[model samples]
Target: MITNDVLRRVRYALQLNDKKMLEIFASVDNAIDENYLHSIMEKEGEENFVFCRDSLLSLFLDGLINEKRGKKEGSSPVILPAKAILSNNDILRKLRIALNFKEDDMLNALASAEFPVSKSELSALFRKRDHRNYKECGDQLLRNFLNGITERFRGTSGKDA
Candidate 1:
């Protein structure tokens, strides 16, 4: 899935308005202007639909971590590694940290979207890339997880993944 879709889903899942969206971006010291944000949120083929890049999404996720888990005291903020690619696994990992979800919580979240998964399967998604048990997270899985979050937090699964 595209980064813009993830951004839109996350925004809807948490019911964040424009002001809160800007604040979330600012929480990690990347203060995105409202017009830029507006373009990012625009659908494809719109006059000003700008593609959301992975690095920007990474910063947003970091900002989300700060917003949900509280920033570490006296510690400077960390930016994404220059060579890092923001994969679906990374996105899920960041969400897990921000939400303080346990394994069961994650399973429940997945199940909430009618995508039941086993604990061991879920664990593989977090394993190191070179590890024998490592599993790449697919777009469908990520979409389902985001949909699950929407179901849990918004009490409705109205948005398409």
Candidate 2:
């Protein structure tokens, strides 16, 4: 479940307009219209807000907001999830859509990161399931990919990792 505050923060962080957000939600099957979505965003009454079920709102908030609780706040700084970092499924889907990179890009990212798996194997894995099912090699592969991406960011300081 996504709290209203979290949603507002994510909306600001992503710099997304209601229309863009509605499109993203609609693409994910949450069929909300733009006007109502906008109204929801503008409404200050948190209790009155209606968040959708399995609507990707949680995922969006998770991937976009970095929770920062200060020392004076009486709690440790919690790393809020970003809408980009929502779930493995969300992550994979976002990556696929954002990069629009062909198979070579995935392979290059892996290889550049020193991952041992070939592009073919990775492609096969992607084909096998909408989300990767890691029994043995899966976790390692994911970790390696993550490491590679981190390394790439370290080098480029680019957005959209």
What overall lDDT goes with each candidate model?
Answer: 0.90, 0.47
Local accuracy of candidate 2 as per-residue lDDT tens digits, 1-161? 13343345334533567666765555433457766675556435565465532335543432222122112333322333443333333344444444454677667666766776665566555553444553233445554554555455455311222
Please report the TM-score between candidate 1 and the true structure: 0.94
lDDT of 2: 0.47
Off by over 4 Å in 1: 81-83, 158-161
User: Which ranges in model 2 have alpha carbons more than 4 Å from their true place?
Assistant: 1-58, 61-90, 128-137, 156-161
Model 2 weakest 10-residue run by lDDT = 62-71
Assess every candidate by TM-score. 0.94, 0.38
lDDT of 2 at 18: 69
**Candidate with best TM-score:** 1
Best by lDDT: 1
Candidate 2 global TM-score: 0.38
Error of 1 at 159 (Å): 2.7
Tens-digit lDDT track of model 1 for 1-161:
88888999999998889999999899888899999999998888899999988889999998898899999887655676776779999999999999899999899999998999999999999999999999999999999999989998899993653
